[model samples]
Target: MLVAAAVCPCPPLLVPEVAAGAAPELDAARTACSDALSVLAAARPDRLVVIGPAEKAGRGTYPAGTPGSFRGFGADLSVRLGRADGDVVAERELPPSLAVGAWLLERVGWSHAPVEGLGVGESLAPERCVEAGREIGVRPGRIALLVMGDASACRTLKAPGYLDERAAPFDAAAGRALGAADIAALEALDAELARELKAAGRAPWQVLAGAAGNAGLSGTLLYEDAPYGVGYVVAAWS
Candidate 1:
């Protein structure tokens, strides 16, 4: 079952190299993410799954030691999902979203649990996401999740999707739901509306809601902000 979870926004700007001189803008969010991961480590789960958005649905699993790079984002930096050993095996590169998750894992020196990654498509249906979440919940031994995705990208005039009048209310409701561990509300988030607002977190958050099941996890909103015009949220559930 889901023992714990950390929700983090997946912007490449979270990386110091990518942010460069503006790196300090996300310092608080980074700290919150670190604290959330500590809670997961403290839970001492048998398995930790990192979930994030990708270009396609049900993409293949990313095993431990998988590599991700930010060179595409103009940063000559790379990271591995787990510690490297001589037993290196070839693997596909992680999507940008999962790459950020990998960065977070590396930042925390995550060695407390075996790690794996699941990449879900942004357009995936809520039911499918929930089914996948249920299957993950039933896996043997305790499980923790590091969910990565961003909220509305249309929060401000300079936002990626350009100022959408509905973005603020949408993000506010989402933040409230995540902070309250209101699974029902999360599950009920309208996919169509989310798409319009360019909220990439919809599918992954629904999966989280499904994974939590009826387990009654309590939640805390660690951080919430709109930096670079995109809504970023850091939250923890236990």
Candidate 2:
């Protein structure tokens, strides 16, 4: 059953090295992420699963030792999902979003439970995502999740998707749902609209909704902002 969850934006810019001189701009986000992770740690779950958006090459399960690199972003940095024990071997590198999740885990020196990752495709249907999440939810023992994905990428004219009149409202609704752990609201998000707005978090957040459907978790919004024209929100559910 789901015991706790931390929701965060998955932009590669969250990494200080990638951000470089502009890193200071996300200090607050970093701090909020830290606090959110603390809530997960406090839950003392038996397993930790990190979920994030991925492309075709990165979709599927990633083992604890899955390697993730920031080299594509001009950073010679790499991170592992967690410590791989025994003979388990990670077959593929984590996608960019999961790579950021791994970085956040490392930043907190996560050692309380075994870790694993799932990279959900942006084009995946909402029902499929929810079914996948339900599978994770049925696993034995206490489980925690670190969900990563961005809201709208079109908050401003300079945003990745360019400014869209619907972007702000979409992001606002998403932020509110996540902050309140409103499973119905999350599950009801419009997939087509989300795709149009470039809100990558839609699918992942819905997965979260599925996993925590009966966990009775309460949520708190730690932070919300649109830096670099992308909506980034930090929330903790416990």
Top candidate, metric lDDT: 2
In Å, residue 60's CA in model 1 sits off its true spot by 3.1
Per-residue error (Å), model 2, residue 5: 0.4
lDDT of 1 by residue, 64-172 (tens): 7789999999999998877655565746798899999999999988999988888999989988888888888888799999999999999889899999999999999
Give candidate 2 regions above 4 Å deviation: 57-59
Which residue pairs clash within candidate 2? Answer: none
Q: What are the per-residue Cα lDDT tens digits for candidate 2 across 103-200?
A: 99999999999999999989888888888888888899999999999999999999999999999999999999999999999989999999999999
Error of 2 at 100 (Å): 0.2
Model 2 earns a TM-score of 0.98
Candidate 1 minimal-lDDT segment of 10 residues: 82-91
